[model samples]
Target: MDKALNKTQDRDLIKGFMKGNDRCFEVLLSKYKTKVFTTIYLIVKDRSIAEDLFQEVMIKVVRMIRSGKYNEEGKFLPWVVRIARNLAIDHFRKVQRNPIQHESEDYDIFNTIPRSEGSAEDKIISEENTRYIKELIQQLPDKQREVLIMRSYADLSFKEIASLTDVSINTALGRMRYALLNLKKLAQEKSVPQSYENKVQR
Candidate 1:
């Protein structure tokens, strides 16, 4: 995607919306709904919960723009995804109290923090070919999983990941590197299909 063009379009849409052109808001939402919805679904993992959270995200986006709280110029998608991520995190804090629910008896990949739960039954990331891969992703260490998801699934840049994760840019890059390496090792150990393994960056 042409970043300059996207930014200009977003700016125009935002300005139009601010000037009471409601269709501009609709167009903006249409442009980004897939990304915003995917970000929420990847985090929440449950279709029903994801949908509910997605509505909350859209509502928040509208409110923020209307209230003049959205000041991130030329970064419309990342700004919106940040709101989605925060709302998903809030949901996790409320409902994800099962940090050790699925720990392997031999080894636990997750640290002490609460972990997000997902299953093969999910509507979005639960394809027959991708279910195991998603499960492996859930098994990744928390920080690495976060970087991988934000980079690969959320399509965030290293700088955005760093800012959102409260780390340095190099630290964000390092986490993504380690996340890929770990996924490779985990794929090999699990004998995951090469097709699915190839989906994650090598």
Candidate 2:
């Protein structure tokens, strides 16, 4: 669907959900569950913890909406994303754990890559390249890595990312800029394929 249509649909769904329509909530969940889960997973890097957090985030969102605590003026996806990000950060703080750890069971980096219509072989090659790039992203400094993951995987605007990270817009932009530059340098150092370089540029 087009961006404008999607926004309209989301608004309608939110209205329905606010009116106690369980089906509308299900529709919203179907649309956003993957994005929400992936955002949490990218941060926590633990599938089990991420899954638990995802359920908690959803429950909180529903309760907030039902109690009229959620702002209807805000865009739904970004609002939910902000909640997910905050909760994931809170989890790390509570556990006194580093959130950037590289530990996951058979994680699929393909979800972070943009979809394209291509041959089976092309898709396979693209997935392999994205896996390598994901590792490169993981190697970045904490701030840079978090910014990159939020912008790239979660489809968050720099403004939203700045707010979430409690940094100025310029700082968020700087981190993303440095992330790309560092990733490109690493790709060159590792002699990754030209196709992968092209993907990074995109």
Candidate 3:
């Protein structure tokens, strides 16, 4: 039980994995997989898509470790998050439509974060609000939407996002600024205040 609650010593395990200790890789996954899943799910908001992206992220990490290309100097979580974020961005680009928009036959994540017990009218109103925000997000331009996701959901800093997206920090900031402006406009049109208002970078 302690192993479940305690933070995994990733450095030693990773170094061991580099030395061909395959069990260390398994240990690393057991320690971090839940956190990785949560992070990806929060961004993608679709269980199947998040699971697919999670596998892709893990495969890339494992391959990098095996290939001796893994850099140990950086924090593992951020590095993994960056990898996941980039893959998510690429997935978005190639698909050109939100995965949730399609009626999927697979499992649903919305059921997991269940609505609070409430009157039917309250539930209806909550769902409508959520759908409205999702529509607002969809209305954003590609770069703005990507930046907003990377910053808000992935929790990446401007510098990290710039590095990942091959843009200057100011450009990333600018994209974020424009994203807020667009989001606020959409919110106003929908007669709602933006939830991410304060988090938006100037």
How accurate locally, in lDDT, is each candidate?
Answer: 0.75, 0.80, 0.76
Winner by TM-score between candidate 3 and candidate 2: 2
Worst 10 residues of 1 by lDDT: 107-116
Winning model by TM-score? 2
User: Candidate 2 on 1-202: residue-level lDDT in tens?
Assistant: 3354345487787788888777778878878888888778777766778888999999999998889888878778888988888898799897786535544656754555576789988887878776786677767888898888788777889998998888999999999999989987888788687688676668
**Which is the better candidate, 2 or 3, if ranked by lDDT?**
2
Q: What is the lDDT of residue 114 in candidate 1?
A: 35
Q: TM per model?
A: 0.73, 0.78, 0.65
| Per-residue C-alpha lDDT of model 3 across residues 23-132, encoded as one tens digit per residue | 78888787778767766865665678888999999999999988977788876766888888778779877778643365375654556556979999777666766666
Off by over 4 Å in 2: 1-8, 97-120, 191-194, 198-202
Sort by TM-score, top down from the best: 2, 1, 3
What is the C-alpha local distance difference test score of candidate 1? Answer: 0.75
Cα deviation of 159 in candidate 1 (Å)? 1.3
Ten-residue stretch with the least lDDT total in model 3? 193-202
List CA RMSD, all candidates: 8.9, 4.2, 5.5
List runs of model 3 lying over 4 Å from the truth.
1-5, 16-47, 85-101, 104-108, 114-132, 191-202
